[model samples]
Each structure stands twice: as C-alpha cells, then as structure tokens.
Target: MRRLIASTFASLDGILQAPGGPQEDPTGGFALGGWMFPYADDSMDLSAAGFDGKDRELLLGRRTYQIFEAHWPYQAHDDPIAQSLNAAKKHVASRTLSTLHWNNSTLLQGDVVAAVTALKSTPGPDLQMIGSGNLIQTLQAAALIDEYNVWTFPVVLGRGKRLFDEGATPSALRLVQSRVSTSGVVMSTYVPGGDVQPGSFVTTEPSERELDRRKKMANGTW
Candidate 1:
C-alpha cells in the first residue's frame, strides 16, 4: 500500500492560497499574493520535507497542475527539485479538465475518493499531493491522506483560502516531526491519529452561572 502525503504552505491564519507569486492565483481580488516570499531564507530547504531521495508520485488539482506545468518543465534538469518533478509520474484530479498535456501526467478516473483509494491499494511509492488546496480538502474530507507536511510561515493573511475551512470534517493528527527554519517557518509532519477526542476545562459539574450561560446560548439569547 502506498502512503498518500499532502504538503502545503500556509499562513498563520491557515490561509493556503497563492504563496508562490502574485499571478499564481488572484481570485477574489486577493491582493496579498506571494505573502511567503519575504520569509524565504537559505535555511528553507523544502527537499528536506519530502522532495528528495524518495519514491513518490505527484497528485495535483487542476489549478496547481497548470501552475506547475507552466514552470517546472522549463527548469534545468540538474536542479534537484526540477528533476524529481519532471521524472515522477503525476496524477491529476480534475472534473472539468478532460485532458492533461504535461509529460507523465494522467487524469484520474471515476470519483476522486474512490480512485485515490484504489491507487493507494496498489503497490507503489508514496503519493505526494502538493499545492492542490481543493483536492486536498476533498481527500481530507474522505480521510484519505496518510501524512501531512505543513510549512507555516510567520505572516498571516486575514482573508484567503484556508487549510481547514469551515465544514471540513474533524479528525485528529499527531505531530511526528517538527523543525523551525531560520526564517521562522514551522515545518511539521503529522499522521492521522484518529477521531477528535473531546474534553473540557470544567473540572466539576456545571455551576448555576455556567448552566445559565449554556441555556442562554442554546436559546440564542444575547
């Protein structure tokens, strides 16, 4: 069985949109594109996360695939990042795109969840999903991702697409590894733990004040 890993760059506010460049994604008039550039430093080597010396495949959403297809192919073959991306097979999850022109790329068949599940069952290298927010949300909803390599930059985008938006299914995750780059990027790896265990800080039974507050909340009273 192959492990499905999702790697993404998020802001302090959990916004995952347009970290690369201004033209990358400007939908909804997102003026804060390329918010991650200022934090870049020599210590930031993403290959350490999962990009090097691994048997992996690329799983991408349509927009991300388009972004990569336009860029990675033009990079020099000697570049480690470019080499890995160029040589690895890519699977695209896009309902609207009927065809993919990128080399070594194939469009996923049938439902995204079912297809990805079947892919995981086959004997192969781990599947790495990169910068595909929409696809990531779908896979996350289905609980299909096995690992998450997240790099949280220091900045925050007040409004943009987010990593765990409202309505995302709740699940638990255990941090297996973590590191901080010189630029203050928090790089962490996590694996799905299980269902979210609920607990509370209230030590004893609810006091009359708390109970009344709960009642008011339930009744939608201010």
Candidate 2:
C-alpha cells in the first residue's frame, strides 16, 4: 500500500500558516506571514522533507493548490524546485473547485477521505502533502496519513492557523528522525504510534511496601 506523508513548516507554537511569504495566507488577519524566512539555512534539506516532489505525488488543499499553481508554473524553467513540482502529479482536494488548469493535475471527486483511501490502496508513489493544512487536518483526523514531516522554525505567531488545533483527536506520534539546521530550524519526521496513552504520577494512597518502609523508618531498628 502506498503511504501518505504530510510535510509542513510550522512555528514554535505549532502555527503552520503562510510560512513561504506574507502574501500566502492572511485569512484571520495574520500579519506575521513569512515568519520562517529569517531561519533559512543551507543545512536544511528540502528534498528529504518532500518539498521537491522527487519521488511522490502532490496532495494539496484548495488554497495551497491555488498558491502553488500560480507560483511554481511561473518560475524559471531551470529552477529545480519549480521543475520538480511542476512535473509531479498533483491530486487536489477541493469541494468548491470543479476543474484544474495546471498540467498533470486532477481534482479529487466526492468524499475526500474515501477518495484518498482509494488512491492509497492502488500501486503508485507515496503521496506527499505540502502546506495543505485543511486537507491535512481532515486526513489526519481520519487516521489516513502515514507520516508527518514537521519543520519547526524558532518563531511563534501568537495568533494564526495551527498544525494541531484544539479539536485535534487525541493520538500519539513517534519521532522517527530529526535534525537541526544551522539557522535553528528543527526538522523532524514522525509516524503515528497509537492512541494517546494517559498516565498520572500523583499518589493518593501509600502501598503496603511503602507503609512497611515508613514503619521501619519510624521504629529505627526496633
């Protein structure tokens, strides 16, 4: 089965909206767009994070798809990132958009979750999701995504769209690999571990062993 991997750029506080530029997304009056630009460095590997679309198909939400369709197609032909993104197959998940203009792009029909599940079952390269926050949340809630590539820049947007919101379903993620860029960007990959494991350390009563130990201490060898 093909795996679906979600790759995103987030702030220190889990904000993932508009990391590329100030014009990317400002729906909620988010003035701090392009907050990740200050932390860019050569040590960070974009290909490893699935940004170059080297060996995977692109899965995008409507807003992100529009942004990419407008920008990547206009880049110079020799641009490696642009070339890779333009050449890769794009599967856009949109409820309002009925058609796509970009080359090698297809509109996902009907229920997003079911369509994605069907695609995953077939033989193809892994699905790589880039900046599709809405779609990511949907697939994530459905437990359809296989992996998460979270590149966290050392900055926080006090108010903005977040990677994990308050409504996120409780679950566990296991960090498979991680690295830090010279600019202090924490690049990490995670996989779903399981349901949230609940625990507590507060003790309300002492056990028999603890009681015996307490008695021994009080008696002082009697």
Candidate 3:
C-alpha cells in the first residue's frame, strides 16, 4: 500500500489556514491570511521535503483544489512548481462539487474514507496532501495519514483553521527528522508512534520512612 503523507504549514499557535496569500481563505473573518510570508526563505527547500509535487500524486480538499486551479495553471509556462502541479494526477474529495476542470483531476466517489482506503491499496506513487485542513482532520481522525511534514512558522494567529484541531485523534508522534530555516521556520517530520502514552511525574503514595521524613521537614526538625 502506498503511504499517504501530509505536507503542511502552520503558525506557532497551530493555525494552518491560508499560508499562501490573503485571498487564499478569509472565511470566519480571518484577517491574518498571509502571516507566513515574512518568514519564507530559500533554505526551506520545498522540493527536498516532498512538498513540491515532485513524485507523488496530489490529494486535495475542494477549497484547496479550487484555489490551485485558479492560480497554478495561470503561472508562467516554464515555472517548475506550476509544471509539476499542472501535470500531476489530483484526487479531490468534495460533497458539493460536481465537476473538476483542472488537468488530470478526478473526484473521489462516495464515502470519503472508503474511497481513500481503496485508493491507498491500489498501486501508485505515494499520495501527498498539501493544505487541506478539513480533509487532513478527516484522514487524521481515521488514522489514515502515514507521515507528517509540518512547517511551523514563527508567527501566531489566535483564530483560524488549524492543522490539528480538537477533533484530531489523540496520538503520540515520533519525530523522525527536524531542521530550522534561516528565517526561523521550524520544519519537522513526524510519524505515528502508537497511542498517546499518558504518564505523570507527580509523587506517588509515600512509604512510612518517606512520611516520617516529610513530617520532620514540615516541623523543621531534620
């Protein structure tokens, strides 16, 4: 089965909405749409991190798909990013959209989970989800995503769509690799590390000797 990877950008406080530009997503009156622009630098290699549509097929939510369809295709003909995105096969999940006009774009039919599960079993390149927060949440709840490449910027937007919302499954992650860009962006990669193992550092029930020691300390005797 092919792995389903999520490559996304988020703010310090976990807001992941509209890292590209202001007009990307303004729903809910999100005034800080373009908060990630200031921290961008050349060191944040998009291609090396598997964020640029290099070898994987694209899995996008309706909103993200709509955003890309309007922009990438209209870029300069020789633009590498546009070329890759324009040529790659896109699997989009949406309940309201009946048609998709982007090149090599197809809609997943019926039950999003079932469709995606079937897609994973079929032979194909690894699937990559860009900035589809809603889709990410769904897949995350289902534990369908295999890997995460989260680029956390320095800024914080108190209110906006986040990468992992409260509805996200409670699970621990193993940090496989990490690096910081010159512009203070922390780009990290993580993989599932089983369930969320809850632990505590609080004191346990004390023994008789421990209790005596505590009593002595309370009385300033020893």
Candidate 4:
C-alpha cells in the first residue's frame, strides 16, 4: 500500500492559509497573507522534504489545485518546480469542480474518503498533499495520512484556516525527525504513534507548600 503524506506551512498559531502570497486566500478578511515570505531562505530545501512533487503523485483540494494550476503551468518552460508539478499526476477532491484543465489532473469521483482509501491501496509511490486545509481536516479525521511534514513559521495569524481545526481527530504523533531552518522555521516530520495519553499533575491531597500557596492566593497576598 502506498503511503499518504501531508505537507503544510503553518504559522505559530497553526494558520495554514495564504502562506505564499497576499492574494492567495483572503477569505474571512485575513490580512496577513504571505506571512511566510520574510522567513524564506535559499538554504531551506522544500523538494528535499518531499513537497516538490518528486517520486509521488499529488493529492489536493479544489482551491490548492486551482492555485497551482494557475501558476505552475505558466512556469513550466524554464522552472524545474513547474515542470515537476505540470507532469505529476494530480488527484483533486472537489464537489464543484467538474473539469480539470491542467495536464494529468483527475477529479476524484464518489466519496472523498473512499476514493483516497482506494488510491492508497493501489501500487504506486506515496501520494503527497500540499496546502489543502479542508481536505487535510477530512483525512486527519479518518486517520488516513501516514506522515506529516509540518514547517512552522514564527509569525502568528490569530484568525485563519488552521491545520488541526475543530472536528479534527485527536491522535498522538511521534516526532521522527526535525530541523531548525536558518530563518527559525521549525521543520518537523511526524508519524501517527497511537492514541493520545491523558494525564494530570493534580494530587488528591495538597502538600503544605501547595496549601500555603492556595491560602496566600485566597487572601490576595501572592
């Protein structure tokens, strides 16, 4: 079975929307589009992290596919990134997109989960998802992703589409590898480990120190 990997560029607050450009995704009046531009460095290799469409097919949502289709194809003449994206097989999930004009692009039929599950069982290289926030949520809920390449930038956008938004399944992840970029971006790779382990530090009986602290707080003495 082929692995399904999801790659994302996120802010400190987990906002994954519009990291590329200002006009990318402005929905909900998100003014901090292109928040990642300042942190970009030549030393950071996106392709080395498997985000540049090498040895893998592309799985994308409607919005992300459209964004790539509009921009990548135009650069295919001289850019390697454009060439790879143009030639890669694209599996896009959308309810409204009837026709896909990009080369080697296919619109997924039937239920999204079922389609992706079937694709995973097929004999092929791993399928990688890039910047599809809504689609990521669905796959995350179903526990379909095999790996995650999450690059967390330092900026914080208080409001925007996030990676693990509401309705995402609560699952524990083990850090497999990590590196800090020169620009302070934390590039971490993780795999699903198991269920989340719940714990607490509270004790049934408070110690004398804890009791004194609580008493001081109650009396406003700090």
- Which candidate's TM-score is highest? 1
| Model 2 misplacement above 4 A | 206-222
Model 4 steric clash pairs: none
| lDDT comparing candidate 4 with the true structure | 0.92
Q: Please give the lDDT score for candidate 1.
A: 0.89
User: Across residues 1-222, which tens digit of lDDT does each residue of candidate 2 receive?
Assistant: 999999999988999999989999989898888898889988989999998888799999999999999999999999999999999999999989987999999999899999999999989999999988888889989999899999988996788998988777789999999999999999999999999988879567888987899899999953
Error of 4 at 187 (Å): 0.4
Pairs of colliding residues, candidate 1: none
Q: Global lDDT of each model?
A: 0.89, 0.92, 0.92, 0.92
| TM-score (all chains, Cα) for each model | 0.95, 0.91, 0.91, 0.91
After superposing candidate 3 on the true structure, give the runs of residues whose Cα lies further than 4 Å from its correct spot.
Answer: 206-222
lDDT of 1 by residue, 55-145 (tens): 6888989999999989888998888888888888999998889878789999999899999999999887889988889998999999999
lDDT for each residue of candidate 3 in 99-218, tens digit (9 for 90 to 100): 999999999999999999999999999999999999999998999999999999989689999888888899989999999999999999999998998887757888899889999999
Tally clashing residue pairs in candidate 3. 0
Per-candidate Cα RMSD to the true structure, in Å, reads 1.4, 7.3, 5.7, 3.8
